[model samples]
Target: MTDSSPLDDNAFSHIMADPALAGSACSLAVACSGGPDSMALAFLLSRWCRDNGRRLTALVVDHRLRQESAREAETVGARLAALGVRVAILVREGPKLTRDLQNQARLARYGLMLSWCREQGAGDLFLGHHLDDQAETFLLRLARGSGVDGLSAMSPIEMRGGIRLVRPLLDIPKTRLVATLEQAGQAFVQDPSNLSDHFTRNRLRRLMPTLAEEGMDARRLADTAKHLSRARQSLEFYTSQHLNRSGRLYPHGFVRLERATFLEAPEEIRLRSLSKLVSALGGADYPPRFDRLQRLMKRLEADADGAGTLSGCQLLVRGGRIWLAREPSAVSGPVPLEGVGSFIWDRRFRIMLSATKKWPKETDFFIGALGIDGWRQWQNSGREISGFSILPAFVRRGIPALWRGDKLVCPLSTQKSDHWQDHGIEEIHLIAGELFGKTAFSSLNMRTM
Candidate 1:
């Protein structure tokens, strides 16, 4: 490997020593775009992996938005192959391109890349984002008047989609990457879109030289991001502690929060906690807007005894506690429970059905949300569950139940048998793992370079 390469032996050594690669060394996938930055990364990583006895794979995502994408991917593959690195190209397939091209492209790119890494059993996915990109991101967020979390910009390591995503070159500059490629006599593709003003990133990039002359260089902006990132980390730590002490997650995509304790926390922690709850219970990809969340938090803490929905989740203030549940509209499914077995219903609750040996009869059932008629019939049955009346109808309707042709088989958790010992469907484990698993915001996991 060339000593002048952006990611030289010393750079790679430093990255390897960090927490990003703390675990036992395994296979890794490096995302490359055939650009100067990514190519330089691939070159250095290939040599490092070889010397360290670790396997490295070069992954390229071809957007296919351009006519030359296929050819470009092939060229990149051949170049990496010459360096003794295995290459895999995933093309963006299906659907005609539309508006919001940049955002859509990024989502598609990451989604595909993460899926590939999981399928390949790669330990970590390395990205080529560097100081220049981090600087641009910071400025873009700054122009939008973003908060400290946004200004912190990109992180050196992130846990996304159950994969470890590491950006080892964040401290290096774009010029260094270009210089590395030049010194090695390697060819790199330059996408014309980088010069187009239609994209905000491109517009900001065009002004970078002018800003640098005025003392707003990438190094300075990136340093600011690091400072804000440190602050964000501190907030994240407290946010986690606050949630654990004040809020408790419940089964079937619900959370039980101690209202008094939640409202007493600092405003930022309060907002962050509420955002975490809504996103987790709602199964929302992104949290609600900050201002909306701020208003909603105030209303919930002070006056929102009424029913309302935010981030596709239903909010109910019951007595002195705040209950967050998935909006019935957000969850729907009538999965057939084949015999005595456990099954996931509505992507929110895991329901298990079982019959005792004393029963000795096969039970057929269909699992679904307890509908309006089911709730009414259940009420008329004179089975008074304590505190059930305080629940909103929408929240009650989402309770999973088993049906056998107009017959109510147990509402949510239990299906009791005639004999106490022979409890039919003994213990339905109503699990809400997915909702609670990602309660913490992703930004919290971000570690700045």
Candidate 2:
């Protein structure tokens, strides 16, 4: 590791100047693990928050993967608390997974931390992912034959679950973080797992030295990632413009694309636009395989009046418009809605219960898709079906519905007449995560040197 100087407030102050962060309140949160990197971040944020007259909280997540994990969490809390930083210890409790332990742990950690941020009214979350982490991620993705977007590595800023995840240390090296801690005479813990070769990252870490001997180093790899990031940014900017010009996202969780507008775009833009539409409407965490996307594009060009399905979404072209809607067969099975609180069902709808209202104690409610059976019942009952006549029959059947046993209680629709006053429903929003209408593609330019 190269000798580096300790970081100061100036290293983090520029993050506050971002216009995207202007909407956030005067409170910030940081993820700390009691390690040199996170510990240094927590200390730096503590002083910065104090000087800026803002509130800061350090969140430590206990994955409970090891026997000492819980105690380690408390130890992290103590260290942050001693630095005059508020600390919250979040525990991940559930059955342990035997496969993909590291990936599972990461998902669980973010789940707990983001939930806490929403509860505490913190809009921005700071993470200590330094240059080495970005370099490792680049090499890993490159090995996997990832495209430009994946190989661009991590961003300095990202929006997750409506929270701004800020990584101000992406340009800083791990040695600088260690130096920062040593300059302040602070003690930090090292995670033993980092040294184990069982994990893919640790294996890559070992190879880094050998690769550096041949003129491939961390700084060079990270710089290549930044260069690719700019190219990715340009592609995303044009893709966003194409999506906005060619499609309309309906409140009923469907998209209508102008047939000619969609087909006329360049091949790359068309693939990207289709990928975004499917991922958002299908609520899939990742985009479909590139080959699958390419194949689907070819089919769309061949068949003007055909239907195809991918990533839990159905794409159909009829009457010169391409209709993208949720695949009814792929809809999540019924989920029990037991309490008077907000819940996200099927990752596509948000159902918020009225805290002031209570339901009958003897009844149980469930949220599921308005399948053909539910639509038949609604139609047979002579309930104003004309209000939903504008939407396609298949699209209407896939919308969210409330059920009491087998009886359909409410079918959420785009019509203005639907209400849940009797059931104490406060609000329902179509919240397909990262859907076309919900968000546009964005990027920020960052200098690594």
Candidate 3:
């Protein structure tokens, strides 16, 4: 590849077109730092996006770990602004960084950037992960004994939340990025952490030269990863087929697994299916660890009726089938109604709380799960559920309930639409989490390798 392909307008256009991502979004949001690689990307994208009539938003996340971080972000923003690109500095607000600083910093960076992209209605997000990063990731996942997906390293495009995260320079070498900066007479900051021996990645980078001398170069590794990525895509196709047939999706935020048919599938397919389900309901990025997942699979394979909890979700086997539900303790906490309108509670339910009064105050009501105490109140109200006893128990603690004072108000089970039940106005609907449909299994798409 030519040196300009990493940042040239024609190259950028080709990358977007070849990947079929040009039509996926109308605007581009780039995660940029003042580093050589990201600055090169920002410089290229700024011109490319403008030429294509696409708006560009560059986000600089100040992780706030070091005192100099804010200054760095400001400098980066100023430089990008000079290039006629819109820049936003997002300061990560979190507790003091201690252990696992790299992981924490990463999560903060992506979380802030992705949130900003979503808020701006930006459908495409770009990052500056190069071929070197891909090679390091392959080594890391190889060391961890990861499956094909892990060994696949990074994809050209990944769908996160509602955004398509694009990596345009993944095939470009780091030297090229620096050369691009040099050619443009642009300056970039060098993070001190990169040279630190304390970080695993730094250690790995130090080892790469020796490994390359032994004939394990970055291109060879990245090529291997690309091959594995294709194989991984094949497995995903079958996995999707299995998911569609293995379980009955319920509109009430749960699923009914046809246990026998699920167990009949091959081991790999079975594992993948279960992992996707747990991740979807648990609202976690990755499934449980391999050991934990294996143990759960063993129990399920025995075909014995039983129940267990893992990854913040409950799996109960009854009458030769499985019922999957979210653990109440794991769901989101109380979200204040604020007023009368539709709002998502814990991402598990879309609650519509209409007030009986024409106007409602902020202190008027709160929404949360119906725990044991709420259950007692529900029983004392002289009510009984006549059907689907197991279903009610599954969501009882987590069923959205609106309360003004000590009164039970309206829980998911209550049919009465009056008094506190009305939430001061109209009826209350306790919708399930899966009502909007569970997203595809992208949790394992971590850049571990």
Cα lDDT tens digits for candidate 3, 1-449:
22442355676677767644565467788888889889888888888888889899889999988888888889999999998999999998868789899988888888888777755667788889988999999998898889898999999877554356888888888888888788778888888999999888888888888888887888878999999999988786777667666666543356677888788889999898788677666655446888898898898888578888788878888887887777877877776666565555554455555554544455746777666677778778877544434563765666566665666675553344454544443544333222212333222321111
Candidate 1 lDDT over 406-426, as tens digits, reads: 776546643333422233345
Residue-by-residue lDDT tens digits, candidate 2, 38-95: 8988888788789778899999999888888899999889888889999999999899
User: TM-score: which candidate is best?
Assistant: 2
Residue 190 in candidate 2 has what lDDT? 97
- Which candidate leads in lDDT? 2
Instruction: Give TM-scores for every candidate, taking all chains together and pairing residue i with residue i.
Output: 0.70, 0.76, 0.76
Colliding residue pairs in candidate 1? none
Q: Who is ahead in lDDT, 1 or 2?
A: 2
lDDT of each: 0.74, 0.79, 0.73
Comparing 1 and 2 on TM-score, the stronger one: 2
List the RMSD of every prediction in angstroms: 7.9, 6.4, 6.6
Deviation of model 3 at 449, angstroms: 41
* Cα misplacement distance, residue 436 of candidate 1 (Å): 8.2
Candidate 3 has what TM-score? 0.76
